[model samples]
Target: MSKVSETTLEIDLRALEHNFRYLKSKLGAETKLLAVVKAFAYGSDMVSVSKKLEGLGVDYFAVAYVKEGVLLRDAGIRTPILVLHPQAVNFDTLIERFLEPSLYSPRILKEFLKVAEAKNQKKYPVHIKFNTGLNRLGFWENDVDWILKHLNGTNAIKIKSIFSHLAASEDENEKDFSLKQIKSFKKSSSELAEKIGYQPIRHMLNTSGILNYTEAQFEMVRSGIGLYGYANDAQIDSELKPVASLKSIISQIHKIEPNESVGYNRAYKSDGYRVIATLPLGHADGIGRHYGGGNTMVLLNGKLVPIIGNVCMDMIMIDVTGADCKEGDEVIIFGGNHSAEDFANSAQTISYEILTAISQRVTRKIKE
Candidate 1:
């Protein structure tokens, strides 16, 4: 409950829990949930976010790299972690930490096997990524035989689960494509399971997939943005709470006259008299330069305050004309009465980018 500093990212734990429950409610008890905690839990603090979800009995946790998993493990998270896009260099660390990698190719699978065999490890869990549609990562459907040839009857890495990503699960225009992805994943998974002589957990649902492709939900589902209170769909978005509230104090207030320029590069020139309030957060803190010179606005006392000039490395200037508040008044970049979507819209970006862009320097205060 106390503020960390002049600027802070207020993470509402209650809202986080609410959002988790809301997403889980959409699925059945049979569906396993893997809470995606990558990118510092969307730049809100993975240690806190993962611990909260772990406390709520989440089935698993996922990260984009081995170090991210190690961070959670070091923080006392005991749940299984699937490294989404693990690199070859971190294989040893991943193995030592028992971090599962999403094996996407024959080469990756072979490399991991060599590491696992040399380490004398057995039955280590590894997820096979199939390129059903998202083509970004994953072994192609035809590579199944090559996968089995390398792993069959070998005392190397064990296949734990198989998954594929949905490219446009949130877009109605891509319904056929999503269905095709599901069908492909299913066929590929079943074929691999038969060849491997057993079934590993099969999952294909990402956040949007869980919402739009319920039938495609296999043995488990990976919910990322939905758990952080975003669904990419207006109907589902209304169901989840906005968990991150970016708030900062108006460190100073100044009165500017006509034709007066503001901030770096002197990009903004006042047409007339205006009140400028400086926020303690800036692009170096994850706001980015795109939000400068009337591109975005911060909310103060329920009124819109347009951002002015080139955003600085440590701060931003907002035209807070006629606002009741002064220096030290609370300024909301996103959250509270103003929504993250609106803030992101003004910046011409998505909620995901805005929420995850907050730099590590911004103190995160967990709201009970």
Candidate 2:
């Protein structure tokens, strides 16, 4: 635990290890585990999280951009890193850092191949993404021949792996759709390999796919939100421990009279005498306006206090009339008994949005 007076996003490495082990337990001994460390490892410290995952012998790491991969490489992360959505402009940096890029379209592939050829590169590793069903940033099934034709004579790069995203693997009602996606990915990957002369590693399972569709585990698996302590399922949620806890101190306390408004635009009005505590965190810190006006609550001294005002850029007021808490008491925005999932649900959003939305300015203290 950190000092109650300072706002901090505590990253518990132990809990992170627990989640990693839990996710790994679902895979076979030979299955490669690629930890998704993009968006700052889901808004926790990316370098710190990658350091721990590296120590745990994670097979690979994935990030959305080349800069993120560069950050990891600069920090001496030796684990093989895959750039999920690489841009052509950074191909030089990508090659320079030994970062593998997921070339999803012909334009990207052609552009990168040209760069690799100019650099006199041989057998550069590049992953290919197919649009199984996600219909996002991937080569369509019909584009298989076009891709093969483009790469037929290129010695500059080799297919490192073939993968696709599952659009609805987490929803039970969408199981059929997920299965269809897996089928499509398998067919596409196989056909491409047959045409390209070698079987690159094939993977289509995301975190939920690992749990719900184990048969399609392929040769590798990607654990993104799962590594951050969420599976989007109640059973899995119970077995995993969240790694980050956002906490802040009550900066001030006030007693409000009847009809007294709190925050901008008089969003919340006291019906009678009420006590309010202001926390030094608000929308700027990831506690968005959707969390204000009693839509969400924070844990203070084991009591839940409703947010009672419009969320400001740097402050939020919470009604704490019945609690024995005082100024300087620690308030838990999310984590522990108050899960991030619960808070996100209260805000009518998902855990991914809430976790990734955390502002970088908040001090992240890692706990061993």
Highest lDDT: give the candidate number: 2
For each candidate, the alpha-carbon lDDT, in order, equals: 0.88, 0.92
Clashes of each: 0, 0
lDDT of 2 by residue, 51-98 (tens): 999999999999999999999999999999999999999999999999
Give a tens-digit lDDT track for model 1, residues 105-170: 878888888988889887888999999877788899899998988887776678889998889999
Candidate 1 global lDDT: 0.88
In TM-score terms, which candidate is top?
2
CA displacement after TM-score superposition, residue 237 of candidate 1 (Å): 1.4
Please report, as a residue range, the 10-residue window in candidate 2 with the lowest summed lDDT. 1-10
